[model samples]
Each structure stands twice: as structure tokens, then as C-alpha cells.
Target: MSYMDFPSFSLVGSFYTDPSTMDNDPSHYDESCTNPSPWQDPGGSHFFSFQDILASKPNRAFTPPVVTCAFDQNGNPSLTDPLIGAPVNSTDTPGATNGQTPPFSPAKMVDLDVYQQGVSNIYGFVLKLTVGGTVLTGAMDPCTLNSIRFDRVLPTRGWAGWDSYGWGSFGGDSNACGVYQSVVRIPADTWPAASGSPILDQLRAATTQDTSGNLLLSIRMTLDGYQNVPWHASDFRIGRVLATVGPQLATDPSHCLAGRWLAGRSAGPGDAWDQPSLYGAPFEVKNNTVAIDLSNALMTSAPGQGPLNLGNLSVYIGDGSTGVVGTPFQTNDILYSLSGGIVRLPLTAEQAAAAASAPFFLASSLPGINGLSTFNKQPVLWQESATGFWIACDDRNFQLASDQPNPGSQPGFFYVTQWGQPVTDASQIEHHVFPCFPNNSAATVPWSGGYKGNSLSSDGCLEAVLCPGTHSGQFCLELSAIWDPGSRTPELESQLYFICLWQKGTPPPPPNLESGCPPQEQMMSAVVWSSYQINTKPDWAEIQRLMKVYVKLFPSMHARMDLSDQQTFQIFSTNPPWFVSYANMPGPATYTLPSGGVIASGTIPYYMTRTIDDPRLMPIMRDLSPNRLLTVLYYCYNLQQETQPTPPPPGEGAPHPTATPTRKGANA
Candidate 1:
């Protein structure tokens, strides 16, 4: 026999009073089956009343609940009980030798060692009592079993501590009747009911599925016999019920298979991809073996089904990478074309379960092209389209320095493949990538990107600034491909351009350009990195309005800048040295302002400007209000040219970039 280590499954055990069938005895509080604290109790009776265990009250004779099991004349446990914990018609015989049943364990909390290697399904546990009639059996629904969370076992206190207040004795009553239960919380509610002599008084089970859909099973047991049982009165009165619930592994091959499966169509050739083309039905993984039926679409006998066209099928093994292209299977990746559409992977149940959650990134070679050809080499970068699918383009032959749009460039085929599916010609080679932005648009203007000429990068790139005429919460895509003015070869490239979204009342961008243009890029970058939107507005009046919104969102960036009549007028003076100059103040410089000054600065680096070359800043500040003038300073301050550190002599340590003494703003 070999041992395999499976993921640990939790088995929660608890006890609760059944108000309908059992009496509501306030004294019968939740208690543990195994209490360490020494307490006086009758011999062979660990069921000490709550008053004796907790309050040191006089000990009372009490019988703990247990499942009734039959015994033979030889004093050996017997499985003669017709309604054992196993399912109906189950041929499972744990004690086949000499008709002796497995000995019952007295503890309420028991560890169940479930073997998933050869097992298909697990029926309910088999619980037997040390002293009782032939049988006591019943099955409770998963919801009802999981709800009984009393007498829960704690690491420090085994079934001792109660997390809930209601589980304790209520209404000034003190009866010590311990409630013991263990159940699995799973999705199913169809638990088999009891069908035998001496119906079980209490039986609960709960189970939950792991990330891989494996069952974390648990069981609960409660026995009731002998009269005056402080907790409640049961309708069935039997002899002394001395019993305990123990673990019994019941395996059934007729039940549903264990573990999960992820299935999808194999990648098809780009030129002949078809959505209705049947490849295989939903597959199942049993014992780490998967069998996909190919007769459905392959066999001509099946109605309306075409002959099975065997294509390359592969299973995705994401080797710690993300995104489509980066994670796509290379020549080294595992490729599978199961024999007769049936293949078994060498993975344990736990490993197989984890694989089901990830989307399959199937890669297929173009028709007529060698599967391992150089041009068939996977593209270096794959930008996931807005449609949540991937579109592959081959630009190996095209030559260009800057990545930009070249509309009408080449009539190459681009593949649109879904997650975990193979690319076929029917779904591959498409002119459009995404539907018109907002999805409800009348015309479908697919936006494309990641090419040369109208690249997403590069200053003044046409695709970078594309936007719709109107703005709303939904996204819109525009064809940002600028037609070749000189008709320099009809190969113009086009890409989907996501319209730049901006906050309401944002200042208009530079004239003769896209509305939001590059400002929205800076705004979005700042918001994503530091949650601060640096002033990018060019108009002084509009800047004031944008500042109001920014100040409301981030009050900490708010700062007051009061300027005097002389300071206010001379602040923008670059020729004559004013009271504040970049030459004198290398760092933040402060200037005293007269009362009632209208300069309000917030979070903007307080740098005095000596020269203003930026087109956004006006040479003269006399025509502008103090607030508008400050706004110009705020915008220019952030626009300072990013300086790179100069290298030292070869083999010497690199020197840091020297700080420029003149605080001059760069041209936008």
C-alpha cells in the first residue's frame, strides 16, 4: 500500500437542542464530552450535569447520547443492523471477518482518515454504540447539521469552550447536559434519511468544498435512552444507551466522481474557425484521469454532428506567469491529444482541483504553417482587448522606429481567442477587436493599438488622444488611426483607442488637439500612483475650477499663499530680481504677503520661478488674478524637466544629478 498526502479538510463538530423533538431544558447547557478538570461522576458515566461540572452542584445520574449498535454472543460488535450509516443497498462490509463489527470509540471528536486515491464517493459515516439495540440511524440535511454549532472543540479546550452565549444554560436554570455534534458543510442538502429499527435520535453531518471542489467531510452523533434525561424527552423509549460516535470510512463507487474538471474546445485554425463546431462534451476528472468523448462530433452516426477532425489540444500549465502572451504555452509546454479523446494526467486529486480554477491559454499553429516555424513564433507582447479576449498580430516583417498607427497597412489575419480555448480560423483573423465603446453604439468601430506610427507612447501620438464627442460613465472607443496625408503607401495601421475619461469640469486641453489629450494620462498616472492629480490645466480660469474639485477631494494638499502688493506684482518678474528668486532659494521658498491677499496654494511644491519658458505660463501676470497666477505657478512647478544623473569616469561611482540653481519651467 502507498500513501499520498492530500490537502487537509476541516471537520467541524458541535451539538444543539432540537426544539421540536427534544425538550427546551434551560439547565441543559452546551458542554464538552472530554473535560480535563476533575469532576465527581458515577462510574462508567462521563456525562456530568452542567451544575456539577460548572457550578459544583450535586452530581446527577445522566446518560450521554450515542448510536445503538448490535453485538453477538461472543461480545464482538455486529453489523446485523439493517440501516447502518452506509447508504441504501450499500454492499460495504467493514467487519467481514467472523461477522465482528469494528469496535466503537468512546470519544465524541474523532479524526477521519479519508482516502481519495481509489475512492469515488463517500457515503455517511457508520456510528455504533457500545451498549444498545440493533441500530440507531438517520441523516440530517447539510444546512441543519452545520447550524448546530455548540459544544465546539477548541484547540486549547477540546469541545470545552462555547463561542456563543445562547449555548449556555439560560433563565436562571442549571442543568448540565452536554451537546456533541460534528458535521460537514457542503452544497448538497439531499442527505439520506434513516430507515431501520430504533430510529436515530440525533444525527448530523456537514461538508464543504475546497478550492478544488474536494469534500471536507464531518459527522455528528447523539444518543438518547433511559428516562428523565434532563435535556428532553424522546418519543422512542429504549434500554440503557451507552454509546459513542466514531469514524467509519464508507466508500461507494456508484456516486458522483470526486475532483473538478476544466474543459474547452481545442484551438482551431484562424481561417476556418466555427463556434458551433463540436469538439467534445464537458469532461470529468476521476482519480486524476480525464475522459473526453469524441464520438459526439467526430462520429457521423450522431445526428447533425460532423466527423471528428483531430486537432492539436493542449492543457495550460501556468508556470507562475500572468497575461495571455506571457503565459501562453511554448514548445516546452505540455500538449495533449488524448487517445480517442481520453487522457489521464498524473496529478493527485488536490493538484487536479487547483488546476480547474485557472483559465486555459491554448495556443495553436496557423493552418499550413509548420507548428514550430519561426514566423509561428509567439508574439512578444499580447495586449488583452477590452472584450476580455486576446488578439494576436504578427509584426515581425513590418519595420518602423516609433510604435504608432499605420491605418490600411497590411491585410494580415488577427486571432480572437477566448480563455482556455484553441484558436481556429473561424474565430481567428478578424478586422475588428472590440465593439463600439459603450457597446450600444450604432456603428462598431473596433479600436486597435500596439503598432507603429500612431503608437500609444510618443508625444502627440494620434491614438493616445482619441476620444468620443460626448463623455459619460461608460467607455467609448474611437478609430485613432490618422490617415497617411501624403498617401505614403496604402498600408495604414489602425488600433482601438479608449476615449480618455476625466472628472466633470476638468479644464479643456490644449487647443487644436484631443479634448483630454495628455493631461488625462498624467492625471490618471498620478491618481494611480499617489492618488494626487497634479494640475495640468492650461487655462487660468479653468484651472481655478479644477482646483476647487481637487481641494474637495484632498484637503491636506490645501495651502494658503498670501502675497503683498509688491510681492504679488513682482512674483512673475524674471528680468529684475524680485523679493523671491530661484537663484537664492534652492529649496522651498516662502514670501510674506499682505492681509486680504488672494493666493491659495495646496500641496504644489512651493518653488519660486526665475524663468518661464512653458507656453502655458504668460510672461506678464498683471492681467491675471492672484488665484489664477498661482494656478499658473502650480502647473509650471510640476512641469519642471526631469533631469537624469550624469555618469562619472569609467569604473568610477556614478555621480548624482546636480541640482539646477535656476528654477526655470520647461515648455509643455
Candidate 2:
């Protein structure tokens, strides 16, 4: 509906003469109350008060464009007043009980009787009380002993009249008295002629007089008591009529009826509560605080070839701008306006490419350890070997045998043929199997064989073997090329040999030659060296420094190694002076070798006691010594035993464990 052609009030024939004109003359009782006498008083009697008129004769008493007041019947004044000298028991009183004495004493006098009489006479012309089609007579004014008898007049039309009252006659002067007031009770015909007719029909015909004395038919309405008006009709419209005739307090806009022209529909899913949609269209209405879901909209004519092409296309809607277009898609793909509206764009090749190629990489580090060390310090290496070549050596002392008769007999090692191990030459051994031992036991050993010393150099061949120890049941081998310092040439290098065993028997054969191998070199520049003593562990700072250097060499590899010694507890009944010394000595000792490299040793002194038979100390010695003694035995065998002196017997000058100090070569 365009504003210019909007319907007007008169188009539907909803016009009527002012309500004031209807009640202009009250003297002509037989005619409709279209014109009441101007000299009549509009106040003084209860009828002059619109409230009393409504209470006395409710329903259609007053027509459209009527002023009304609400009154309480409970507060009505008495008809007789003994204090006023009006006969308290007089049967002549209009409302008195027949032949009965009044409730109050006759000696007292009340002024209300006179006052009510004056009000009734002055307002008699304007007020009318009706019951059904007939008007009652001799109805005593409840406010006084005065009698109010109406001329048996029946209203022909629906109530239509005016009201007036004289204050001077009722003992109040012009200043306090109201005069020349008019009211018109219009017939129900003045209502809307049709369902959708203009709402001003009853208002225009029934009431008149504006606050500015404009003489327009618009009524100054002030809504008060409950009037049985229809739901569609607004209280404001009714109030305007009353306000035009009398003073009225302005009402808040929110309190006004929800008119169609005043407010649009409430916010909802498809309403303008959100920003208007702007897609292949031109302009858009903006609205903040709204949300939109544009998952499945299509843009066909964009910078791409597909029918649902979403490509480079500048679109703006409600403070939002989109550079790319999207084709028919789900809620996620649909473009949303800045203010909150969904829009679809055509699909383009660029968008397709963007969706296809997303940069992602699989990144991982060594498991178990944390921080950067797991990534930087753990070493990973690959290798190649020749057939028949034994890649590892398993010493008999470090291996377990079923029987003691062959305790020293070697159980042979295996070749590396699995997990990235390849045999390229005739001397390259493909596979070899051997018994396994506990990984943590001193007897457990890794696969170790190198073709009998210089044979590796002569035959130009390589072999690998695995010894799966009992404790750790997995075998791992890594080999890398080491660079020759003088020739700057790469040669086959042994990186590491790891063996874990599940049972006592031989391990399975290695994989075929198709397995990959590491690059061959003389000496590997990158290597991770880590060691921990029985009592001392590397702190984070030391680990970090080592990790820094390790990362630089093996920029892309992880290297890790953990080492521990068996724990030993020694107790003495008579504490030795150097008990702390022996215990402290057991902690791992780190030192810088002559080669400018670092090494750690797991060794400690055995403290001696005068009373070695203490029962508590016995079990402690037993539990803490067995594994430690085994480790010491292995160390002694490897380095050629050079015993440390026994500790001096308490106060006896016996040799102390530290009495003897032995030093072995670098190999030890």
C-alpha cells in the first residue's frame, strides 16, 4: 500500500454530526436529545456528573460520544438528616419508611438534606434515570430527603442527550460552578458500517469540540470507568472524545492500542526482525542485532564456470561485504550479510581450489618422553647389510642358556632384514636367529656382530643380527653412513643395536631385502649420548643443553637412551665416618673424557660396618645387593677386575672400601 493512495475516513461513509448537537436542547422532551437548552446547568446534581449518570442507568443509557463516570452505590447519602432540622421521622420524606421513626434523634440537625435538595433542583433538567424503556418517578435522591420525580417520558431512540447544572442556585458561584456543558448519546448506527471500515465512524458523528476551540467534530476523549466497548475499538479513540470535552492527562505511547499503522509485526523467523536478505537483488534494509542462516543459496552468474559458481564477486548488504561468491550449498557455505542475512553466490574455480588444497602435515615425535627432548634427542637410523654377514654380536655372559654346561657357549646373533634393513652385496647377511634374554638383566644383550673385525673392510659387505632379550621383546637396528674425516667420504656406520626378547628360544628371521636402508657414510655427525647413574639422574637443564646440540646435528631425527644401575642399601650398627661418602659415591658420576666428549659411570663404594650381623641390615643388604652385584660383576669382567679395598673394620684399621683406588683405560 503506497502512502499517497491510502484510504481516508470519509471514503467508507463513516461520518456523523457532532454529539454535542444531539444533546443541545433538553426542554423538548418528546424529540431526540439532539439539542439541550444552553441555559441548563451541567453540574450540581449527580446526573451532571457523568459517573453518576452511568451508575443510575447503565447499558445504552448514553449513546456513542458519551462522557461517563463510575460511582459506588455503597457511599450514597441518606435521604433524611435529623441534624438539619428536617423531620427525622417524617413520612413525607421521599425515601422514608412508612410510619416508622428515623434512625437519628430529631433534636440534632444535619446540613446534607438542604445541600442535596439544592443539587437535585439545579441538575433536574440534565439528568435522567431509566429502567428498560420506562423512566421511574418519585425516586428520592439518595443524597437528601428531596424527591426526584421524572415526567413519565420514554426514550424513543437509543439514549441521546445533553447535561447541564447551575452552581449559583446550589449555593456555589460561577467560579466553582460549571455551565453550558453538552453531551450527546449517539445511536449504535453510528458504529462502523463494515468490518474493515475506518475506525473513526462512531467518533466523528457522536462527539465534537477540541481543546483549542477548533469546533472540529473530533472529541477530546478521556477514558475512565469500564465501558463495554468492543475489542477492535481502541481505548485511545474513546478517550479522545472525552478529552475534547474535558481535561485529560496524556497517556504513554506504549499504553496506546497496538494499531496497524503504528507498529509492524513482531520479530520472527521470516520477518524483518533480521536484516533483509540481499542476494541477486540490489538494495537491502539494514537491521542490527539480527542473525541469519544462509547455508543453501546459489550464485549462478559469478566469475566461475559452474552453474553454482561462487567466485570473485563484490556484494554488500547491511554493513557486510563479501568478495567471494558461493554456489548452491548448505548452511555453512551460504554467505551472511554483515547485519544478518543470508546470500548465495555463484561458485568459482578459485573457491574450488581453496577447498581442495588445505595445507596440513603429519607431525610426530618419540613417544613417552615430553618436551622438545623427545623430538630432538632421540636418534633414528636405517641400514643396509651383505648376505651371510652377522650384523651383531651376543656375548655369552650377557645371554642365558637352558643348562649350565654350556653357560659360556655363544647363542649366535641374527642379521637385520626387517624394518628398513636391506642386504645389497653377497656378503650381506639376510637373516640370523638366536636366543633372547631379559632386557633389564645383566645377562641380556643386544645383537652384536661385525664379520670378524677387518672382514667388513675387506669384503665390502655388511650384516645385521638381532638378540631379543626376555624383558623387552622387540628388536631394533639402526645404521647410518659415517663420514671419513680425511677423505670426506661416507662409509657404512653402525648407529645402534637394540634387542628385546619374549622367550628363551631363538627369534624369528628378519624381513626380505626389499626393506629400505639408510644412506651410507663413514661417521655419523649426529648422535645422541645420554646416561644416568644408579643414584643420580639428569635434570631438565642438562637435558635441554644436550637437546640443543643434538637437535642441531640431527635436525630431523629423534634420539633417546635411558640407563640405570641396580640400587644397593648398606646399613651398619656402628655408623662409619664415611657412610655418607660411600652412599654419595654410588650416584652417577659424569666426566669429560680426553676426547672432549662426555661419559657417565654407574659405580659406588660399599660402606663397611663393625657389626655386619644386624638382622634388619641383612635383608636390606640381600635385596639391594643381588642385582647390583651382577652389574658390578659385568663391569669388572668388561674392564678386567681391579678390586676396591674393603672398608676398614670399625676402629680396627681394616682396609676401607675406598682404601684401594683403581683406574682403567678409556675402553673400561
Candidate 3:
């Protein structure tokens, strides 16, 4: 008594009966059953079985990484640090001395790679046994249920006209490969259709690589009552590999642009250039910084995909310094207007968002090579190359502002700006004020007290000068660095130059009711300083000889002038001299000479005291159209000297007495 009868073994019965059915069905065709049937098990029950040969989300992430961190200053684990703040000396360990600084602060790194979980829905099978009239434990207990089929397949793949190849691979994107959905009528089976139920509830596929790195796809099937089954929707709707492509790059522009960069500490009328050049054009230096006008680099339709996103774009500065040696400076791109080509980029500084809303030099305390404080400013040439997925577009001179440079050494500021001269291979300009001009140090680093009441007696030699100003004059310090086209050497030799000078106004008597004073005493202060640093000490004999001929001729050097300390080569002069009391003229007064010795006091008449060594200063009666000469504003004042009970030694700034006759008072 074999279970399957000959008549039942034909079409439907043969399709229904397989070794899988026999293995999954317990007590199949048992003779001791209450109802003698070949389809019934030993307990007069039937069995239901489902098998899946495959299962996939092509773009799904299998896992998100977990992170570990140390306690921050705030001690809150959840409050993540943005990691873009001023650096702290992390090397400041326990009991470290004050003001201790670490060698460097290395940037933190992050893992950007993701391990793609390869596909895995190979095969799966489900089997359940049940009596025709018996109730099962629950819906989850599929081991004892009646035979069932989908009401109507969903995720509907349409194959109405064709009978041959019905599968379609249609949803591929950059991140992952698409699915192969097929619509084939389930082979006419003996199982009954479970109508009104979610026949095709959901379908998903995933992709991964095997030990050999061959990609495998996986998918799962789900219905209303029975919600999960392993069925891959690969190109075969089974676990299979995916085909992918790699990436490429872009190049530089031959004829891209040109413009000026206008930035620095001093950028106004008659000052250094306010707009510096971008396409290697020549501009002027202002406040130790250079600005290039990139208005020409402006474009409506960006070269690449879309409008330039400055947040995603990195800025580089290409000076003559690093491009020849690699390692260009990576500056922060300030802003690229969404609608215009006005791209403004600031160099060398960081944590820009945290900086206060003041000028860079005023807001920050970082110092350049000069002892005076300065913010980062490195002039550069903008290149146009790309590295991997990003663009490499800047070359910089690191000598200007390196990480831990010598205290007073200026950063290398090699640019290709022509000062009305020919450009060469080593065509360079190193300046403190931007575009490229050596700084006028006196105004930049004003003396502790004003220059008017100061002395040359301070420990070091001081170089000072006077420039014409609105009222009196301004004392300025000058650095001598020649602009040499042949080489990049410091201008260290002696040279002759002139500086316009100024003098303080007369100090009023008690109650100090001085007001409405006009511009006074416009003159030239001759400067003679030695920059010869040939040895550890200066050559006093050679220096003093040159200085004495010019400077000792003036009254400022009445005290000893020593250039032994190379640091103090500066020769200061201003008039009517510092540390002198100006006297008030009390009109014309008559006085009698004394038989006994007694110095008499007399009022010097008020009149313009003019001295002309050269005939070039001719006063024009009227304004000339293009005036070759400047009409200097003249202020009038009377010169009156106060009598000192005890005069300074004749060697110490006392004027040599003149034998001219004058009125003397009679006291004896």
C-alpha cells in the first residue's frame, strides 16, 4: 500500500509529491490512521511547506559606527566638541611649569570608509503540519497550518504579453545596483489560493562581497499573515554580483583670469594698494597683508557641477615659495558670492568664526617676524590643479609665517609684482605692510611715551624720523631694505635718504589755555643709521666717523653717539627739539644794560623768520593749473627763549654765544 496511487501520480498529484514533501511530512501514509488516506499523516493531519532559493537593499547600511571619547572641559559626554576652537597645550601634563607650550597640536582623524555588508539570502525552507479540523497555537506557529498561496502577487512586475523572459533589472543608482523583478505564474499547484490577504506585502534586496571579493545579492519576501521569507531580487531575483565603475579628474585653465587684491593695515588715499592683484598683477602692500581681486575669476556657470560651494571648497595660496618645493599654504576661503565673482579669501588665520569683530592686528595677538604683534598674512599665487577628489590651487611662501618661526623673522613674502621694473626668475618682494612695503615702525610701534618727551638715553640705539603732518609733524621709524631685482638679500649697507619732519607746539603757561593752534614747524629730519651687522659687535670707528659728519653737525647728537650695539643704529631728531621749554613773547620791551653782570630780558618782535639755502621755494602769487610746487600751509609764531639760572654745559646742547649787540638791563 504505497502512499500515492497511479491515477493520483499523474499531473496535479506528481507536481505536489516530491522527496521534500516526504521529508517534511511526519507519519506520511501511516496505515493505523483513523481515516485511511495517503495524504494524511499518522495523526490524520496534513503539512504545508515553503522554500526560498534566494533574498536584498542595495544602498542599505548594515551598521553605524560607535565612537569613544575623553571627557571635555565641560565634562558632558553628550555635548560633542565641534573641534574648531583655539588650541590648548595638551602636553601640559601634571605639575607642568606655567606658560609651557606643546610642540604641536596634531589634527584629529576620522575613518570615512564603510564596510559594505555583502549579499547573503542563499536559500530557506518552511514546513508546518496540521489536522484538517484542528486549531493551531497562534499565527506565529506556522509548523501546524493549512496549505496557502498568495491572493495576487504585488510589487507587481507586469508581463502580460510575453511568456519567455519576464524578469527586469531596473532601479540601479550610483550607491548600489538595482533589483530583478519577475512575474511568472506559480506553476499550477495543488495548494489553494488564500484570497483577500496581502499576497505581495513587501520585497527587499541587499548586496555584499564574498571571501573572493565577488559581489552577492540577497532579498526577502513577505505577505500579510506570513510576513517574512528569504527571496533575493538580484539580477536573477537571487544572490548575484553587481557591476560598478570608478572615478576621474579635471585640469587647469590656460586663460582663466586677472585682478588686484586690496588688503592691509593701511589702505586709503595715497596709501598702499587697497586692491591687490590676483593673476600675478602688480599692486601695493598696505597693512602687512596683500589682497588679490578675483572678480575676474568670477563666473555665473561654475566649471564643475554647480555653483561653487565655498563651504565644500578649500582655498590655497600659491606664492613663489612652496610651489617650487611643494607644500603650499592652505588658507580659509572667506566667501564666494552666490551671484558674483567677488571671492574674498583671508590667509593663515584659523577659527575665523571665533575671532572678534575688530581689525586682524587689533583682534589677535600672534606676532610676525617683527617683535610687534601681527595676524597671519601670507601673500600667494592661486594655482589651478587637482589632487584626487579635491583641487590643489594655491602656492605660498612659508618663510613669512611658519608654525614656530624665529621671534622677529618675517614670513617669506615672495610675489611676482613689478615695481615698474622687469620681472625675473627670482623676482621677489618682501614687505611688512601689505602689497609689499617695509613698515614705518615708529607709527606702528609708538614709543612707550610720545616721541616728544622721550630721550636717546634709553638703553638701546633708536632710529627716528619726522614726516609732515596736518598740524606739526609725525615721528616715524624706518627699516632699510632695498628692492633688488638680481637677488633676495636684505638691504644692509649704508644709504642716503631724507624724511620730512614735525615739531611739537609751544606749551602754554599756568592754566594752560592754549587752543586753536595751526600746523607748525614743517621741516626735514636727516637720518643716518648703519645696518652693517658684519660681526657680533658694530664697527664704532667706521660708524661714528660717518654719523658725526652729518648727525653731530646737528644738536641731537650733542650727547655721545655710540653704534657699538648694532641694535641701536637709529639716529633720532625733531625740532624745535624735545625736552625744551618754549617761552612766551611779551611784546617789544626796552631794557638797560647792567654795570655789574646781569642777563637782560627783551621781547623779540613777531616776524616771519625765513631762511633759504636753495632758490627752489618760490611763492606763487596765484594757483597754477598743474602746480609743480606744493603750497605748504605756513603757521606764524614768535621764538622766545626762557633764561635758565644754570645753563646746560656747552658740550651738552648749549648754543655757542654770538657777539651781536643787544639791550641789557642795569642792576648795579
| Full-model lDDT for every candidate | 0.23, 0.19, 0.17
Score candidate 2 by lDDT.
Answer: 0.19
Model 2 agreement with the true structure over 576-626: per-residue lDDT tens digits: 323223333321222222222222222222211111111111111111112
Query: Could you give the C-alpha RMSD of every candidate to the true structure, in order shown?
Result: 31.1, 50.7, 44.1
* Candidate 1, 1-668: lDDT as tens digits: 00001111111111211111011111111122122221111111111111112122344332233222322222233344432332211111111223445232111111010000000111222232221332222221111111111111111211222322213323111111111233222222222333232222112122233354333333322122122223322311111211122222123100111122232232223312221122222233335533332212121112111232223434433331432222223221011111212232344454455444443223344343222212234311111112223322111011111112322221121122333232333312212221112221111111121112222222232232222212111121232323322211111111112122222233433332222232111111100000112243454344444333222221222222222122332232212222112223222222222221111122232223212211112211111223333445544332321222222334646322233222111101
Candidate 1, overall lDDT? 0.23
Per-residue lDDT of candidate 3, residues 1-668 (tens digit): 00000000000000000111111111211223223222111111011112111114463211111111111212122213221111111111111123443122111111000000111011011111121322111111001000011111111222232311112112111112111111111111212232111111000011122344322211111111111111312212111111110110111110111112222121112222222112211122222222332322211121111222211222332322111121222212222111111222333333232111111111112222121222144321233211101110011111111111111121111112122112232212111121111222211111232222111221122222212212111112232222211111111111112121111222321111122111111111111122221121223344343233212121222233332332233221112221122122211111111211212221111110111110111110011101011101000010112222324333655433322121100000
- Which 10-residue window of candidate 2 scores lowest in summed lDDT? 8-17
Q: What are the models' TM-scores?
A: 0.18, 0.14, 0.14
**In terms of lDDT, which candidate is strongest?**
1
Residue 567 of model 1 has an lDDT of 35
Task: Please say which candidate is ahead in TM-score: 1 or 3.
Answer: 1
